[model samples]
Target: MRVVIAGGHGQIALRLERLLAARGDQAVGIIRKVEQAADLRDSSAEPVVLDLETAEPAAVAEVLEGADAAVFAAGAGPGSGSARKDTVDRGAAALFAEAAQRAGVRRHVQVSGMGLDRADDPGMDEVFSAYLKAKAAAEDDLRARDLDWTILRPGRLTDEPGTGQVHLADSVDYGTISRDDVAAVLVALLDEPRTVHHTLELVEGHTPIDEALKRI
Candidate 1:
């Protein structure tokens, strides 16, 4: 399978690329900076320099051509203001989903946050409200598109080494999950089409990651 990943420079994105390559699947990373291409060479991924924030849908779809699946993993990290959060997180994701449809790619996946209930949470919203809102919007947009989509909403991300065990369910806990574990789940979902059209929340758990994904 050929997978095209948006925001390929992210730590989690790179991990996913490595996992895909290890499985003999092709991974193309869409990066914003030309220099970022060099980083992907060591990870066995081809980097396509493209900015999701400003690129047109047609241009984005061109990069997605011949891809078996497209994963929306781009986001504006810390130091980005609220405006950029909407533009990159929500707008870019939405555009990517639409472009994937235009390119006739049926398989799509999005990396979202766990606390995206769309309810009014006073304390947490104030701290990461923009991020939550953007994730919610992106999920909703993907759900409305014409594709076999799976949205994986992960808990607070930790940089700790992957435990290879996780909780996958409809209702989520706000526990921390490793980026490596999330990448493992993403690759698992690609092979299991039954996970399509389902939005699952993921976090570290007692069961093994492969077993948890099989149950999904």
Candidate 2:
């Protein structure tokens, strides 16, 4: 399969690229910086320099042309202000989904966060609240699209090595999950057409990745 990923340089995206490449699949990573090209190449993924925040849908569609699937894994980083949360998380995500439609790529996987259910809580930190709202908006947009889309909302992410085990379901309690485990689950989701249109929650658990997916 050929997959184009937004935020190609992100921790999860890089890991996913390596997994895809290792399996002899084509992985295309869309990044804004030319400097990140080498990193993608090291993972055996083709790098395309394109800023989703500024690129028109048609231009992004061009890059996604002939791709088998698209993954939206972009985010504004912890240091970025709330404005960027809207631009990158909400705006960019919407743009990528539209581009996928234009390019005729039916399968899409989105990296979302858990606890979006409380995004509007009044006591939440301003920036964190905005981030949650942005993610919620992005999810809403994808859910309304006609494409075969699966949204994965993982809990707090960690850099610890993946255990290849997880809890996957329509709704899972809030918890922590390793980035490595998240990437592994994404690969399984890509190959599971039965998961289309499902919004799954993920966190560390005893069930193996493949088995967890099967239960879904």
Q: Quote the lDDT for 179 in model 2.
A: 96
Whole-model alpha-carbon lDDT for candidate 2:
0.96
Best by lDDT: 2
TM-score of each prediction = 0.95, 0.99
**Candidate 2: Cα lDDT at 148:** 100
| Candidate 1 runs further than 4 Å off | 123-127
Model 1 lDDT, residue 138, Cα: 91
User: How well is each residue in 1-216 modelled by candidate 1, as lDDT tens digits?
Assistant: 999999999988999999999989999999999999988877899999988888899998998989999998899988887788899999999989988998998999999887676446766645368877888889989999889999998888988999888999877667989999999889988888888999999989988877886787
Estimate the TM-score for candidate 1. Answer: 0.95
- Which parts of model 2 are misplaced by more than 4 Å? none
lDDT of 1 at 55: 88
| Local distance difference test, candidate 1 | 0.89
Instruction: Indicate the residue-level lDDT of 204 in model 1.
Output: 90
